[model samples]
Target: MNKASRSTVYDGEVTWQRIADEVGLSRQGAKHVYNKAILKLQKNEQLKQYWVDLIIEGRATKCD
Candidate 1:
């Protein structure tokens, strides 16, 4: 979860290859873990509000 969270914190600029190497998983496996973490986060009400606040305050940024 730490590795996945760090990658997401960087706006996904970190590649799956790097995360996979660090976690001793294949690229696909790393992606799977990251996806699962995201699915869990999506269910967190506090996190949802945090994102909504960021968006409302114009502090949210996404990669093009």
Candidate 2:
């Protein structure tokens, strides 16, 4: 998803095909993985907050 967000291939958006190729999975498999990750993040509040905190820390460090 990060790669997709940063990609510029499809009019500034990356395709599932690109993600699949990078990860050695079929396009459908890549989509499945992405969906599964989203579900996990949604269902696990602690895990989600951990990542949110990490992102905030990363931004703070980057700014310094």
Clashing pairs in 1: none
Model 1, 1-64: lDDT tens digits are: 4656555544436888977977789999999998887777699988778867877675433432
**CA lDDT, every prediction?**
0.75, 0.82
Instruction: Name the best candidate (by lDDT).
Output: 2
TM per candidate: 0.52, 0.61
Model 2 — which ten-residue stretch has the worst lDDT?
A: 4-13
Predicted structure with the largest TM-score when compared to the true one: 2
lDDT of 2 by residue, 1-64 (tens): 4576455444345889988877789999999999998889889999899879998997797789
Off by over 4 Å in 1: 1-12, 47-64
Error of 2 at 31 (Å): 0.5
User: Candidate 1 — worst ten consecutive residues by lDDT sum?
Assistant: 3-12
Model 1 reaches what TM-score against the true structure? 0.52
